[model samples]
Target: MTRLFNDPTAFADELIDGFVAAHPGHVRPVRGGVVRATRCTSDTVALVIGGGSGHYPAFGGLVGPGIAHGAAMGNLFASPSTQQIVSVARAASNGGGILLSYGNYAGDVLNFDAAEAQLNAEGIPTRTVRVTDDIASAPASEKHRRRGIAGDLTVFKVAGAAAEAGYVLDEVVRVAELANERTRSFGVAFTGCTLPGASEPLFTVPEGRMALGLGIHGEPGIGETDIPSADGLAQLFVEELLAELPEGVASPKGRRVALVLNGLGSVKYEELYVVYGCIARRLQEAGVTIVEPEVGEFCTSFDMAGVSLTLFWLDTELELFWRAGADTPGFRKGLVSPRPRVSAESGVQKKPSSEAVMVPASEESRAAAPRIVAAVDAIAAVIDAHVEELGRIDAVAGDGDHGIGMQRGATAARAAAHAAVEAGAGAGSVLLRAADAWSDRAGGTSGALWGVMLRALGTRIGDEDAPDAHAIAEGAADALAGIRSYGKAEVGDKTMVDAIVPFVETLVARVIDGEQLGDAWDAAAAAATAAAAATADLLPRVGRARPHAEKSLGTPDAGAHSFGLIATAVAATLTRKDFAR
Candidate 1:
């Protein structure tokens, strides 16, 4: 459990600040995350790697000479926003192209892909390689769907080494993909982790039981069994990894591999060494050779009593890169030549926020802005009230951070909306500013989708006039379109899309039938509520919950449920006589 923190919501930011302060010579703080304090060669490809913040050393700690050039740190258990990723990439670029890499979670993929496209459009060459190395998340045939775990270290190490060797962006991406394809990891946990300010752990293992194939984001394991001995656990890891060797490797015999025994927080160095001793003997008995075996915390979930073993099958080229010199705060290998420090004045500049500008609008549009602010405030209040329940539901299958993410987003949105209204902005501008704030603060799949929804609706409801019932309905429809296009989740996927689809359909139909905005919204909110409840019976076909689909059989998706709650709250706000359309 995380015992020390000023505020749970600000933990990630605060930790990053401390990390930079501690490693002043190695890294400097950027707008989105941390970058190498030392300058790199102009022709070297920039390797930007990141994900949710709980996995330390993994992201921010890996920024240095032979590893990551920059890291786009997100909030705890949440992917960084697209804007955040772009900021890090822009700061890291040194004439050479950028290579974005991270775990293959849905949110990371969505945000990183968007950042890649945006960078390319802006004439900055960029590409991405999502690390999908967790063997337990998906079957061998569907390895592409697997989520990244402790194996993230191997991919990042290889890519960073290649970039340090002055490889081009295309070559760096190629090696990183190869590294990902060659790596496989399996994990087990004896206990669950608790988030800051949370009363309970995300999930718990029964007294003497252990969870098998657990995730790094505090997600519960897919299977459970009685706790095994140190030797037994090592044998299990070796057997599981050897059973599914990468495409090229026919068998473990006569092959060399880089082994990483990763401690997923709370597991001491002595415990890891004990497990590694048995693992070493087992691999040697199997006629396999191990190189550069690492036994410590490489990536972690905060205070989770678990361990993961990663097998990186090495070829000649991979072996060379694996043994290469690198220097970073968390990881150090061989010797790296010291480079000159980056000048403070030459560091990356913070990008201007969208909310800083106030667009002109008609009196009617400005008059409606207060109602938007009120609705956002109501949303924050409702989310605050149900944060625990939402976290509990999400813990059934997901990482159990949906409630925290929604709280951050809603609170930020409410503040932004109020500021926009005070600035005499129109309803559209208020929504737009709030959307940016939500996405920037929340930093996850839900945050990204909500930003898309609000941005689309706000764009449709320009600042020229007050929005009518038909116009509002049209805006909702546009929001639906944007969410579907951006997230690629359909109605039955057991995501927020399920509730959003019904709400938009009901709202559009009611408005078409000459209903007032308030009445139409009430109907839409009710429809969303029913649809959200219905999602409990559907299996998740996408996102992190898909792997543990059966566990969530009787629980509604956190995203859908939270959307329903927000819609209901907004409906109540719209029905108020003081809220003029």
Candidate 2:
């Protein structure tokens, strides 16, 4: 959702206009959406950069002191036209020389190369440097086939430094080529990006899986994998990228590397740390000292959910250029980092929800109508306390928003109960309406399953037939059959079935003596506890969660626990008279 611009078609112009507007003293706009630094140094070689839109600062924002002399901006993710690039080349060229530079991709090659040839024809001598750093793109024998990712920033900096140091255009281009030779990148995608005005993803990836080796332009990846933890995913990328590096590849004569922890688009800085932590450890383990690690959104694809790891093998020369002072809107040499004085002992801690399985218990004829309201309130309170925990569990195995789902459901249920109370609705009617509200607000697998059980209870208690013990038993049986049929869940499947089976089995047995509802509820709760405990033995059979399904064996299913608690709380407060409504 990079919507700071007004028009999708006019994105290039709008973006360049904004850049010039923000730094009036630093840059001047050229036609075809290019911007050049206003300051002049005709004696020095000039650096010219160009790229498509959405990769900010690579071309435009980087046009400032110690960076690019000019930038050519293109339509959203579309390569700049030959004319657009040549326009910038003419403006950025100093009297001494001009060096053309850009990331390597098919469209970029066509546009920038055409511009370079056109510039030479016009008698303005120029040299071009192409950046291609993504190692996953091809084997070493075909390294030229790799795509340029975040590594372009480093390549541009080296080229710019050469130009700024009064080197000829040839020398600047030569240094840019050397930087490209040593750089490599790898990336993983948790989600895909949508092009502006397009409804579907630019690339396709199945839900709940990360696409490995994907490029910035929504290109296909080697494959998809499930990542349940940050550490696990980092290992996969680092180990695979380093395995086939050519001898003499990677920092100072291959002794060290600089890292760019780049967020492609929508990934947050908070989540980036999880990946960076693992990457730093792997680099240290491989005996590669990291000179300077930069973490931020330098390269992006219009809110795509991914990140790329780029390594620069530094020599004394390139290391000096890296350490040289430079500032761009996106690329900064040094930003404020708070001192790492650890006063903080930190502990750090997905999905549509599933349904709850509920069974009715037979109760003796008794009077206890006044306490039902208190019981419903208690049930809502229990749901509130576990909302955050439930969401965390779902995120691990599912879409990672179950906490939000549960909170919404609990809030709606409580509101419904209060609304009914204001209108003088009775205890049974309040529970009925509250359950309906929950079903309407919470629309996942969990919602429907729980809804069916609550509806069955309200109907059974509200019926005029005065259901006998056997009638209530039959109702409980119906609820069980519906959940099994609808959710297609099986016992020991790591689903609500774990808690549900025991609760129903116990209630069915207790009905024979026409037990009081409160007493029957207590029995069912005990059974639920035991059943949930038993699940510690089974591995997960579903939910697309990786490796942890084995370790999750000891933890109760969050969905099942929620189901049991709600049912037990309801049954414990109602008597035979309470069922009369």
Candidate 3:
């Protein structure tokens, strides 16, 4: 368990600050995360890797000359905000394009994809390669959907080496995709990890038991079993990976494989070495040749008592990149020459924008700003009331951060809305400000979705006029479209879309049928509530919950639950006498 921390919320920031202070030669502080202190060759592709921060050396530690050029580090167990990824990418970009790589988690995918689109829109070429190497997460037929584990290193190394070799963006992406395909990983945990301020572990195993197929985010394993001996565990890992060879590889025998016997936090290096002894023997007996085996913590879950084994089948091309010399804060190989450092004053911080975007509004629209603020406040209060329960529900199948992320987003939105109202902003401007604050503070899939939803609604409810029932219905429809456009989740995917779609459809229908705004909203909120509750019967087809879909069989999605709760809360504000007019 984590024992030292001033505040759990500030832990990630403080950790990054200390890391930069300690490794000034390797990494420098950037607005979103840390970038390589060493200069990169102009016109060489830049590799930017990132994810939630708990995985130590995985992201920030890998930023240097022969690895990632920059890393977009996020809060503990949450994906980096889109802005963070963009900033890091921008700082790392030279004349060449940017290549984004990371584990294939839902939040990471959503945020990274958003940043990729934005970079492209700004005329900076960008590409992404999601590492999917955890064989336990999905079936062979659906290998593309597997979660990345320790195998993230294999992909990142190949991509980074390709970039350092001065390969163009497309070639670098090809090498990354090939590396992802060749890598396979499996893991088991003796115990779950605890967050800094949490009293208990995120999940736990019974004494003398081990959890199989565990995720790095403290998600409970898919199954449990009696603890196995070191040799037994190594055999289990080797057999599982050997069962499914890469498409071109017929067998592990005679293949040169790069192996990583990684300790997941609390597991000691000596323990890994003991396990690797068995692994080495097994591979030699099977006529497999091991090349440059790594035995230590690579990607970790804070203090999880677990280990994972990754096998990267190496071809001639991959072997060259795999053996390439590299230097970084965490991992290093061979000799690396020092490069010039970026000036701290010029490259360290990104100045905040002082320019404000003020949209003109009519007197009637401006008068409705207080109601928008009240609506956001109501959302915050309702989320606060049910936050714990929502987290518990999410913990059943997903990482338990949904409640906290939503709470943070709602609280920030409320503050931003109130501030905008005080500044004589209208309903649209208040909602737009709230959207920005929500996305900036929350920093996850839920945060990005909420940002899109609010911004879409605000665009439809422009500040030039008092929004009527028709405009409100249109705004709801636009919100739905925005969510679908950004998140790509369908109505039956067991996400917030399940509730949002129903709410939007019902609201639009009721308003078209001549119902008042308040009446339509009340009806829509009821529909959302029912839809959220009904998610218990539907299997999750997207997000982090998808891997543990069975575990969530009897529980509603946390995002859906929060959406329903906020819709109901906002209905009250809509029905108020002063706002109803």
Q: Which candidate number has the best lDDT?
A: 1
* Clash pairs, model 3 backbone: none
What is the C-alpha lDDT profile of model 2 across 327-352, one tens digit per residue?
Answer: 55666674322212212122100011
Model 1 Cα lDDT, one tens digit per residue, 1-581: 78998888888889998999999999998888989999899978999999999988889999998889999999989999898899999889988899999999999988899999999999998999999999999999999999999999999999999998989999999999999999999999999999888889998999999999999988899999898999999999999999999989998999999999999999999999999999999999999999999899999999999999999999998999999988899999999997999999987765563437699999999988887888889999999999989988999899999998889998999898998888899989999999998998898899999999888888888799887777889999999999899999998999999999999999999888878889889999999999999999999999999999998899999999999999999998876344234
**CA lDDT, candidate 3, residue 559:** 92
Report, for every candidate in turn, its global Cα lDDT versus the true structure.
0.92, 0.65, 0.89
Better of 1 and 2 by TM-score: 1
True lDDT of residue 395, candidate 1 = 90
Candidate 1 segments whose C-alpha is farther than 4 A from its true place? 349-356, 576-581
Each prediction's RMSD to truth: 1.4, 21.0, 1.7
Off by over 4 Å in 2: 1-5, 250-254, 334-581
Could you say which candidate leads in TM-score? 1
Count backbone overlaps in model 2: 13
Say which prediction, candidate 2 or candidate 3, comes out ahead on lDDT.
3
Q: Residue 180 in candidate 2 has what lDDT?
A: 85
TM-scores of the candidates are 0.98, 0.56, 0.96
| Arranged by lDDT, best first | 1, 3, 2
